[model samples]
Target: MEEEKMEAEDPNHNNWERRPESPPELPAPPEPAAPCRRRCDSSGGRALLGISGSTSKFLMNVITVDDYRSTYWPKLESAIDQLLTQSPGDYIPISYEQIYSCVYKCVCQQHSEQMYSDLMRKIACHLERVSQDLQVSSPAHYIEKFNLALGQYMGALQSIVPLFIYMNKFYIETKLNRDLKDDLIQLFTDHVADKHIYSLMPLLIEAQSTPFQVTPSTMASIVKGLHTLRPEWVQLAPTLFSKFIPNILPPAMESELQDYAAQDIKLQQELMQNGFARGDQSRKRAGDELAYNGASSCGSSQGYR
Candidate 1:
């Protein structure tokens, strides 16, 4: 066997590594993709007040406001229906955060007015349907059923109240001159509890026969809490001086006539009035029965007062 010849090399050469003829260069870091700008339609672009190009970028998944309205709104409606179900443990299938975010975006995009009107109409329609769907079997439980329906309806709407309030301040309070809560209550009362409230009206009125069960503070609260939405005049204080032909004044509050107006002037008249103070001697007054112009409270003031 022929002896293998050793190639000549310096001892230091072992320490030096041999380099490949051509080293593969690391690929240059890919140019950062241009800030993924999206071209949105007229309704979506930055030119529009609320929604900007940035919104489009963030909401890349959101096609357009109309698209959200068509798709997501229906999903929201489905969730609402689920909330309205009779099952006590029932919950909406859709994510609340996602729905709220969608609503927020829509409102922020200057689609607020349309969104507000649409929401109101949809809510009203649902309330009407709920009113019809409710079963009132026992006459005794009519109020109970009505209360339950109101509670369920309110629960279904509770999640959306924040969204409702967003437009309520701008649209309902300003343009409509109405309270959203009052409006919703009115709707429920009209559609669900109309008859119950009608029958229970006399119970709520403060009269000689029906003495106030609550304290002064509670009465104040009731007056403040129960704002009437109806057009008929509903005063917080029942006046004894009504049905004045020309000018009929209340009886003098003081024992004797203590006139604010001087007696000398032809137009001026001095008058004493009977005042009811916080611990007055005359706590009770006669003729307390409130005479309703119309017996039906179904057409009564929708508001609390």
Candidate 2:
């Protein structure tokens, strides 16, 4: 066997070629791949933008000029510049939020109340057209969709009181495009004053009771709305908010209810304690069972011996 091994090791005896080491085998080079940008066709992107983008779009659509300039104008300018680079005034996938922001800025004027009436009408019409797309689309399409849902859901718990509170803050703190101010007033008169802003009034009050606070300006504005428009909305107002007048409301409100905060904290604490206690008991029981079994086995072994 040793002789055969020696024979095999003999350099000239077999397939051994005396050569310097060949280059290490390399993995085959990967082929070039196409770039996969996050995009859809013009209309498809627009359709997706509907659900995720509409709330921000709608907020932009309704905000006054000063509000836009202060809160959103810079972002709008950047989006527009990028949009122009892609396809002139009308980019195929221009977001609903972008379009609304641009239109609001374009038509707004500092002192005049006439510029936006026509524009507002156009916006309302456009919103109606996009309704089908917006209603059915997914929320993940836009970055702001979750924020919007969170806002709406939180608002719903308190009957959407926060929306009005936000509206009030923007209205008084910011000098609006006069046209938008008037338009909002008119729209509110038509929709809320004439009907059931008060129907949800009780729910709003209940939410307010939860320790959710309001800003001074915001609170004042709500009072103004209630005092001025209560009569118009009374007949249609739901039973809950009727207490708006009978009860002198609190001077302020919080962003979220206090009770909800308390409950959430309590639940978290209970879960943590219960989990810890259960785990501790389980470990102790297992240790005890193991010791008992060991003791019983040892006694049996001694008796057998």
Task: Please tell me which predicted candidate would have the highest TM-score against the true structure.
Answer: 1
The predictions' CA RMSDs to the true structure, in order, are: 22.7, 28.6
lDDT by residue (1-305, candidate 1, tens digit) is 00011012112212323222111232211211122212211234455435575665564333357665675467556645655553433443444444444454444445556766676677678777766655444544443444456556655555555535545654567656887777776776566555344443343353212223433343333322233323222342332112111122334343222231121121112111223233542544443222222222212122111
Candidate 1 off by > 4 Å: 1-66, 86-93, 133-136, 163-165, 169-179, 199-305
Q: In candidate 2, what are the lDDT values of residues 72-116, reduced to their tens digit? A: 444434433332233112222323333332333332212122323
**On a 0 to 100 scale, what is the lDDT of residue 122 in model 1?**
71
* Reference-based lDDT, each prediction: 0.43, 0.34
| Model 2 spans > 4 angstroms off | 1-117, 123-180, 192-194, 209-305
Worst 10 residues of 1 by lDDT: 1-10
Q: What is the lDDT of residue 297 in candidate 2?
A: 44
C-alpha positional error of residue 40 in candidate 1 after TM-score superposition, expressed in Å: 17
